[model samples]
Target chain A: MNILTINGISKNFGSIAALKNVSFFVPEGSVYGILGPNGSGKTTLLGIVTDVLRASSGAYKFYDGSKPVNEIRKDMGVLLETPNFYPYLSARQNLNIVAKIKGCDAAEITKALKKVNLIERQHSSFKTYSLGMKQRLAIASTLLGDPKIVILDEPTNGLDPEGISEIRQLIKLLAKEGKTIILASHLLDEVEKVCTHVAILKKGELLVSGDIDGTLSKKHGSTGENLTEQKEKTMMEVVSDDLEKLAGVLKTLNGILDINESEGVITVSCHTDELTAQQVNKHCFDNGIILSRLTVKNKNLESKFLELTK
Target chain B: MLHLLNIEFLKLQRNRSFLILIILFIVSVFGANYIVYEVSTNTGHIVHETSNKSFRLFEFPEVWQFVSFISSFLLIIPCFTVIMHTCSEYTYRTHRQNIIDGLSREQYITAKILYVVSLALFATILTVACAFFIGMLGNDPISFRDFRCVFYFFIQALTYIGLSFLLALLIKKAVLTIGIFFIYSFLIENILEKNLNRLNTGIENIGHFLPLSSSDHLLMFDILKTAMRLANIESYAPENAYLTASVIYIVLIGYACYYLYKKRDL
Candidate 1:
């Protein structure tokens, strides 16, 4: 069953359109990723679905669209944009408040804190937490009551390498438990790591959406047949000190599907059958450059978008 | 309603600013009464009935008026508390969190309305308790006469906090909402009411119809009217007139808060 179905949801702030006729469905038990850059309406769209925001025009429903939105929200946990607990309150206190709002047992607070490894420091004020800790606390709260679905917007944002890795592991674990997770992030790498289905948003528009696990070929109203045919493509992560130059040069390479640069690292999804890592390394070397790091994975989302719509 | 109150209580029980405001509220209530008592004692001229006798302001029924009047000023403490707490939910973005966690937009506003009502009731109960305590220390028989002012005080408390809630909802920031509420309710509204009252004093004194001024007029009891008669300044608007205005302002401001939260995006 689809966990959520959004229909023509549009939101506007004055004359600036934040979301324009955006629609997508999140399948139950799938890790859905909303991929976009900054100012791309990822957060705004999430805000609308979460009911904290009012859409100028449109409709949406959850879990078969039968229950009231408020009732539907009880079974779903969300961490939108930022950690939004009272700074003066302790982590435990914060979760206690959420527990009351959701009408769950008090033990859920302890379970949530322990899940995020914040049990020891749950007594600390939220204002005193590090960015990573604050994010973890938000995750802890999001996972309370073993929610059927979790919506996290940029869940790993502002985290160190270890912190990001930890959150990714936790998300993967949650997915293993059959909980549907909808994660929004600008990084293709983050989405590629955990998401099974992906939606690409650009400037308040849906560029494309499909599954990365090869099942999108028959998705409703999908032109994802080419996506299945392009299964041989590889995702390559390349990092160098000069990222802007690396990203700029990789675009000229033939058969590159998609190039995403973030934090001095360039991730390229390419046709591995036509473009080999050796060719990439040699091309950089011939251009008076050295390859610092390179790793290839099985597949990617946007590369599939480019392939499906090619 | 109880569940919503529990949610707010869970948030505020550990909050430092909220707790500090509660303390200040208690202290200010007693301090204001003590100041009035001291004036009545030290200066035979300052607080006396027109019969040339020094009337104890803390005796039985009069204690109700005295404490409720003090509570009118003390209502600022709770009103500021309401404004600060409500606006901080916006500042901290927890109102969004609350809605995300299964509160409908209506429920969210309902929770706030319940919160405002609780603060008003709390102030009212505290004033009533202080009245009983002060009246017990006096020689007059304990009576419920003049106790109706306590209910009017409750209405007055609702007006102040309801207006504060509206400002907090419309403003969505603690510092700006508190500053505007203080200046507008205390300063600007006063000037407006004074001028409006001057415009048509013969037709029920329109100044008493101002939002806070309507409630302020509720505390002009027999003693206050006697004192005003001494100054030859008539508070001619009857109690029922002020009562009607206070109730009307409370309902309108309460509905406005509900309407603002409903129509606007958080």
Candidate 2:
């Protein structure tokens, strides 16, 4: 069953179009990821879906049959932007408030806290909560009443690596329970790891979307029948402090996918089958330049997002 | 609606400001009544001694009037208190959470109205209890006749609180709305009345219709006289005109509050 169907939804603020005729379907029990750049209408799209902001045109249908939007919202859960709770209220009290609105028993509050692993600190005021805990509480609130569709925007944002791993595990567990998840995030690797299906958006337009493997393979220029003909190439992602100098040095090398600089991070994608990380580091040291970060991994979501967004 | 009302009361109970305002009003009510009792006693004794007659000055309508008069001054706290409570939902962004947590716009609005009404009733009960206690302190304690008059005055106090909350919803902020409510309800009405009286063409014709004026006059049991003074015609006294005007003001303002709250984003 289709959990959510957004049809030709467009939102504009003054002259700047936040979402331009965006359309997508969230199938039941899939971890769907929405990938976009910083100002690419990710938050706006989530806001409209969560009913916090109205769309300028178009309509969306959720899985509550033909009920009104307000009633349909009971089966849907959304966490938008930053976590917002009553700062003076304890985490338990905040969840109790959510329970009251959802018309569920307070038992669900405890259940939600347990789901987020915040039951130990449920008595702590939201003001005392770290950013990770606040986000966890937000996720807890969304899980209350056993909502069918969980929409999270930037779910693991502002978390340390450990917190990120914890949240990613939680999201995986929730999806395993058959809850449809729609994740909107700018962090490409996080989405790539967690989401089953992926959508790429740029400049308020849908660039592409499909199953993650299919979409990533298509971006890397793979045809459906050409799987056996694909060559095995080892990929390495290099992050350097001095992007211009590093790009100049990388330009003189072979076996480089491409060197791209965005904002400040310069990524040198080299085919590791011919030259390894040690070779790149040695060449950088010989050229009197320092390499800030170097790692070897497959060409993943970040590369795909950068390719589409750029 | 009952569930929403229950949630609203829970919020009101938890709010520090709401508790503080109620406590302050409770203290102010008894404190003001003590002053009224002391002054009335002194005046009654002087009248009895000078005239060589027992002056039941604190009996019947006089005690009711004295208590109600003192109460008018203290009613501002509850008015502003409820206003702040209503506007807090908007200014503090609690309204957004309220919506996110399964409250429809209508339910959200209903919760606020229920909260405002609850506060108004609470204020009215406190005012009445203070009046009853002040009556006990009088030289001639209030009879049932005086108690009935105080009951009417309590209704007027409840209306005043409701009107204040309605004004708050219309303005959607505590500071500016409550400031304007106080200035216009207390000072502007008086200044307008005095200006109208100076005109000599008609006396304060429109001042009584100003939100709190009719209720104030009705609570003091000068409804007919005040209406006559407002209309400025010599013998045309609209009987119970204060009742008519007060009812109309409450309904119209209540409707306006509902309308604006429904359309407002927050």
Candidate 3:
């Protein structure tokens, strides 16, 4: 079932577009993650969904069998940004107010507190709680009434290892219960571990999005071609004053593979993909030209993000 | 509405500062009464017993009037109240959480309005009660006889609370709103009145139309006195103008608040 649909969503702040033509769908009962940099539009997307920020132009619809988005909103709980609570109120009181506002059972408060493992600190004022505790309390508050869709933005931010693991476990457990969770984070590893599906955004534009492993696998495949095929491909970029000379000399060597010089930069692909650094240096030395820089090509999220966003 | 009210009440209950503020208000009212009673007696500004023996403590029928006067400064409470109430939401970033927790834009705004009204009414009720008890000391029987007076205090409080909410909503900063409120309430009005006094003509009357000043005049002076003052200052009276201007101010403020809230990213 489609729990949420956002079509052609665009949001602009002054002249800077925060989100542009961003469209995505969240299937029911799937853990969806939005990955992006600091200025990326992940938070903006979540904000628009929760109705905290109106999109300049877009259509968003949520459904649990033909009910309106408002009804779906009632069923979904969101935690955007940092934990915010009345400093003077106890955790239990805060959750109680949330439950009341959401028109849910007060008993759900206890259940939520238990879910976040904050039952012990439920009676403590928010001000006295630690940062991790406060974050957990926020999660607990969102989990109230057992909302199906939980959108948490950077949930484990500034947490210790133990706290991060605890929250990761909690999120996994929530997903196991068939809850639809949207985790927006800058940390790709965190998303990789917790989310079954991922969307990458850059400069208000979505770069890539789909199943986590499948998406990364496809990106990796582009860089995973055989060494000989890659060698004949002239895939490495080199910049030097004597690029023509370097290309001319590299063309005759047995392991020279393919060399293409364009705009004063020589692209050389060696037959050995995993050659020792010293061997490449000795080859450059025998060529009688400055090597400049040698880098081995590898596919990772960082490189893929750079390639797509750049 | 009940759910909104319940949430507002719960928020108020969780706010320890609110409870402390209530305690302070009660003390301030009692203290103001004691001081006024002592000062009036010492200065012979009032008689312990009237010539007719009907109205006793002071020229005014009740010492609660003095408490009400004191509560006018309690306008400071609401000014600061909305700052802590609304601006803190921005400062602490709870607004996003609030929205995510099923707070529709309308419900959030309505909740604030309801909370402000509730606290304003409570403060007004307590002040009027203080007035009632103090008036009883004058041998005037306190019961439903003075409902109008109490109701007047309620309206006065509502007006201030409304003004405070509007200011806080517009300014969106506690320090700035409180500062502006103080300047508008005390400095600007006094300066305008003094500057107009030099004219020796109708200009002072315009201060009445300004926010809070007109309401203060309506609450403090009787209709005849207000009308006469208006007539003297303007040479002609705009009978419907006062109500019209107040309504316009309220509507404009309400719309502005809603617009800002909806437009703000939060």
Candidate 4:
């Protein structure tokens, strides 16, 4: 059964639309990722579903029968944008508050702390913790009561590389235990590594949403910002005297999805590995042109990100 | 209800601001009363014997009003604590976090109201004890004659905290909220009430129902009223009217707080 269904959810702040007509469902047991770049309304959408915000014109439902939303929240663990805690309270103290709110046994607080590897410093006040420790404490707080559904917004924020990997593993482990996870991230590498399902949002619009492989494999060529999957394609920087003619001539060739020109050189982007420099040179030479410089190199990250939303 | 109270105290137990403010309230309650009592005795204003006493605020029966009146001003100390308590939830963003965890908005606001009520109860009990101890020190037969002043003090505490709570919710910053509250209570309301009194709009008027004017009227020093009566001056609002208006203000504040909380996006 679907765990959550959002129907035409839209939110506006005065004249600026934060989310517009967004709709998607998270299936039970799937690691759903709400993928978006900065200011893409990922947090706003999550805020609305968690009941800390009100949508301008839509509704959402959790699949846990007809319980009131706050009652439903007790069974669903959520860690929204920032890891806010009473600064004077220790990690254990903060978790105790969370445990009481979620109605978990005090015994589980120890287990949650241990899971996050924070039992060693559990007595340290939250303000004394490093950013990574604070993040781990928040993660441990969400795990209290062993909730069925966990929704996290940028859960890896402020963590070291090891901490990031550890959280990803923890998320995977939670999925294995039949608990559904919803993660919102701005990094495609993060989405590709841990998410089983993804909804790619850009500028308050949902570009696509579904099984991760299906969505990334089919839509990555056009979405343009899937940096992790960009490794599957070939990038050839071709330079010729007549940059405009080369760009036009290369556009006519097969598998050449995009071409860009910079400093009198053409950067041809092909989504297939079969397209190589030789084929491009032959095609150019036959069209009465010779290359000045030819090299296969990395695509400019900035250019690719600029081509993000459709 | 117990769980909710526990949740509030859990945060406050470690908060230095809350602890310091509470300590200040306790100290001010005892210190101010003692200093005034000693000064009155030295100045020959209060006689240990009840008879032939002039301006006997420290004597039996009158001491109840004296202590309550003194504490009405001292209550600002705990009122600051109340403002800090409510504003911290917003400052820390825990109000949103609490709702996200499982608390309905109603529960969050209800927790705050209960906290205010507890503070009022504590302030009242302390005042009553102070009154009882001071009243026992007198040689004359002591009576609980003017004890209703203690009740008025409780209502005044509630009103101060309720208004403080609402202001914190609106302002969301401790310093700014307290600043606005102080200016309104000390300067704005007193000026407005003074001007409204001069207009002579009649005995029954909206000015009588100003958010704080009724509480101020109820807790007015009994000596001040007696001196005014001796000078053939009249009270603009009757005692019962002040009591009724104060209760109405508390009820209205309760609803406005809940309504604002329910509608706002935390």
Report the lDDT of model 4 for residue B136: 78
TM-score per prediction, in order, is: 0.86, 0.79, 0.78, 0.86
Model 1: per-residue Cα lDDT at residue A208: 71
Chain B TM-score list for all models? 0.93, 0.82, 0.78, 0.93
- lDDT score of model 2? 0.74
Model 1: per-residue Cα lDDT at residue B176: 93
lDDT of 2 by residue, A1-310 (tens): 8888888999888899988998888889999999998889888887676666678898888764587666766767778777767676789987777788888888888888988789999988788998888888988888889888888888778888988898789789889999999999888778978899988888788877778887765633222233223333445555677778888988887677677777776666654367788888888888888888877776556655675677
Model 2 segments beyond 4 Å from truth? A12-17, A199-235, A238-300, A307-310, B47-58, B61-66, B137-177, B187-204, B223-239
Q: Candidate 3: deviation at residue A138, Å? A: 2.2
State the weakest 10-residue window (summed lDDT) of model 3 chain A. Answer: A225-234
Kindly list the per-residue Cα lDDT of model 1 for residues A212-263, writing each as its tens digit: 5543443424333444454467888998768877877787788888999877
Candidate 3: give its CA RMSD in angstroms. 7.7
Per-residue alpha-carbon lDDT of model 2 for B86-121, expressed as tens digits? 777666566766776667777877787776666667
**Cα lDDT listed for each candidate:** 0.83, 0.74, 0.71, 0.84
- Summarize candidate 1's per-residue lDDT along B1-266 as a digit string, tens digits: 88887788888888788899999999888788778766765664543545577565778778898888876887888988888898888889999899998888888888888988888898888888888887887778999999999999999989988998898888888889889988998799989977887785567567768888888888866777788878988656778888998898888987888888888788
| RMSD for each of the candidates | 5.2, 5.9, 7.7, 5.7
What TM-score quantifies how close candidate 4 is to the native fold? 0.86
lDDT of 4 by residue, B139-236 (tens): 65687888899999999999999999989988999999999999999989988877776686755444656888789788877778877768876455
Tell me the deviation in Å of residue A56 in model 4: 1.8
Pitting candidate 1 against candidate 3, the one with the higher DockQ is 1
The alpha-carbon lDDT assigned to residue A131 of candidate 2 equals: 83
